[model samples]
Target: MKDFVSVIITAYNRQKYLGYALNSVLNQTLDKDKFEIVVITNFEFNKPNYKNIIDIYDNQEYLGEKIYKGLHESKGDIICLLDDDDMYREDKLERVTSFFKTFYPIYYHNNFVTIDDKGNEIKIIEEYLKIPPYASFNLPEFTLAIENNRKTDIRNLLKLNVNFNSSSICVRREILENNAQYLRKIKAVIDSFIFYSSLLLEGNILLDPARLTYYRIHTLQTSSGNTKNIKEYKDSFSNLFKKAVEDFYIITEMLNGKINENILEIVNEELLRYKLLYKIFSGNNILIKTKFNIHLLNYYLLSLLPTFLGNLYIKDQYNRTKKVRSFQVKSSNIF
Candidate 1:
């Protein structure tokens, strides 16, 4: 029997374009005998054109849980994930199958695609990444990229970051089994977290240069999902910032003493970013009213304003960001 490659999709009420995603997998250049696709849904799957497909039902309110369950249930030698609204290239599985056949462990690839919503193509979100002058060789390049805050890497990946777009990754089954317990801890989009965790465990992650995937940019995306309404702005930013803080601590712990200097620099930047984000949320009157008491109100403002202003200064070090530059010029030069 040939080694099986599993393609898993986690979706909720995305009936409009789920077929595009399913067809993308079915059309893969990889042999049908060698791979299978699993669609995990909260609703019953009624589509008849699915191939080698299995439906795993998850009633959880969060999409992450559905993914977790499907990932756990899959028994293929290699595994990949696709979101409901996204589609993959015809050669996606072929590229991944070849990579895993050789590497057989932790590996991810670069992703190139456009974001489209409401039948219109939006601006391209591309990056020109350059590794810092002084980065430690202790960790792999992909891990370094994630740590150093470089979202894209034209050369070797120093760390796992945006370069490992979830749709573009494939991994060995052993990794999932070995890290089964840790997978439960993930609640939000878990790809980034899993990539970082794999690096911490294996000390190396391979990246193929082939951009063999299409991550559809749709209106129902997680980022723009519930925050489109003006009324949800403050709460959205607040919850987002709080989640950032929690992720920071988790990553710091994951890195342990193995922390590389380049990674630490990025962590400091992220901390500052969250601090600034919290401050911005505090300044919003709508968020302030959600809580009671003058003490709590003052507490929110006191913690937020200074850090928010500070993060703006840190972000100004890069290219021409007007918001950060203006904030830097107005604030005291205490850096």
Candidate 2:
């Protein structure tokens, strides 16, 4: 198992938690000689004692450039992302390598825990993964069929929650090499795009229930649980919705001209719903209604044909969001 994996850390000015992350990788159960740690960092701290650190720097203007620099510099058969603020359990490498050997999945994971800025333990992510919608749709059967035919299930998979946590995932190098050009094109949240694309295109996925990594949350971080003012919350939701739409379009285009009408209708309908919800939540009637494709308009009209359909939709959306936040709370206790 000599030089079997490459661990890439895209770090900025977060020095407080960097040591724990670096130590986690260095303390892995696998042989120290078997893996290399390539850190793409801008912060100039005393480097760790690890022998294999391949540190590089970027202009710091864009976060993605820092990650791109690291990804290009690293040379390993298997690649894993370890944010400077996150830590991996000692057994993470062992489990990841073992799982990858047996299952040729685009992505593999164990479990992830979140830690607050104060370093309090959070809950595990696996416990929060809502069981996919199954009653109304034969999703498992469809997934299996796609796998059997060696085709990508880009549509159905994206409709489900994003499963890959950047710090918890290990991907094959060939996949990265093949998608390098596409990866560079993405401007925001490159890890999410890469993980989603991999999961959509590659069928074999492994999920071990054991917690193996810690995702840190801090007030300075955009995606943390830090309390925000009304304006901040509005801005955050707006960004989230914009990214969701962008990801949807990207996935839809990637299906090689094979469009699934049912999924298209569902996604378009949901996007419009989300837009309307955002406007209402922000108490801003000035926001224009989202323009949707013909399929979405039909779905909207059909839903509204029944009395109080709009009210019910809003109520259900709130309830579902509550469930997701509840899951997030429960998941925050895992470290």
Candidate 3:
């Protein structure tokens, strides 16, 4: 039999889509008895005979806390994650288990497609993806990204994008058990914390390029729709970036060994543009924390940054940014 696996599906507010997600798990190509499905939620699950369901009452607001509780309840050595609104491919567990056997990665993230509330495929999210079973210390990109001295240069050259989907994350049981305290307090950013923490602990983190899950995108999921509103969207993303950077710093401090300080990586110049926006609007020196230079203008990802700045309300700052023209960018790198 395959090694026992636990699929921890968090059914928070999106119970409406829970059936589809559960169905996907139940219909896995792998043997059903090989894995247990642990549904973590605040509400009651009336489904009969599913012994793996656990109701978490307190710390109901943060998804991380619920996951922490789920970890304790799980009996599997190989842990898989799924959101209430997402679904896995039929062979997901089989493939993931196979990777665990072959690569022995402590952590795993599978590729996924972004879908709407109706399950219509919007776009395939391929964030900083690599081959199956890439260890952080072993991967050439990870080594180079940390070794680089300049912050902006590291941002530009390092292509290891960690676009983590909660449903796509799978890890060994010990990572969750060892970092119990960190996971409980992390709120919705739990996946990001686990990712960085695993990297810091020198755990083998596998980024499986196979699209094995469907990530749901719905309202309140406005981060996916950047084209809808100009200013509001940028603000939303800046707040996201702010949370992530702060979380990175927190992880670094908590795991304070000789961990690499490439933690404050900026995914795209667009996000940097918003960071610049905050400084310019708040009467703070724009270049105090950042030295936005020529290397940033190399990609096609953030050419829109300077153009967006050109349309700003502030005149002097706009003119200063106007001369700092030619901001190129690649695709938006998900952190």
List the global CA lDDT of all models.
0.52, 0.56, 0.57
Give the alpha carbon lDDT tens digit for every residue of 114-154 in model 2: 56665566433322111111111111222121232134454
Q: What lDDT tens digits, residue by residue, belong to model 3 across residues 51-156?
A: 5444444427566678887878778998888888789989999998887887777767776765666676654322211111011211122212122222233232
Ranking by lDDT: 3, 2, 1
Model 1, 85-155: lDDT tens digits are: 77777887776666555555454554545345332323332221111112111223331212222233323
Those runs of model 3 whose alpha carbons end farther than 4 Å from true positions after fitting are 45-49, 124-160, 222-242, 261-335
Ranking by TM-score: 2, 3, 1
The residue ranges of model 1 lying beyond 4 angstroms of the native Cα positions read 1-3, 49-51, 103-105, 118-122, 125-164, 224-227, 232-237, 247-335
lDDT, residue 19, model 2 = 79
TM-score for every candidate vs. truth? 0.66, 0.68, 0.66
* Candidate 3, lDDT over the whole model: 0.57
Clashes of 3: 6
Lowest-sum lDDT 10-residue window in model 1: 128-137
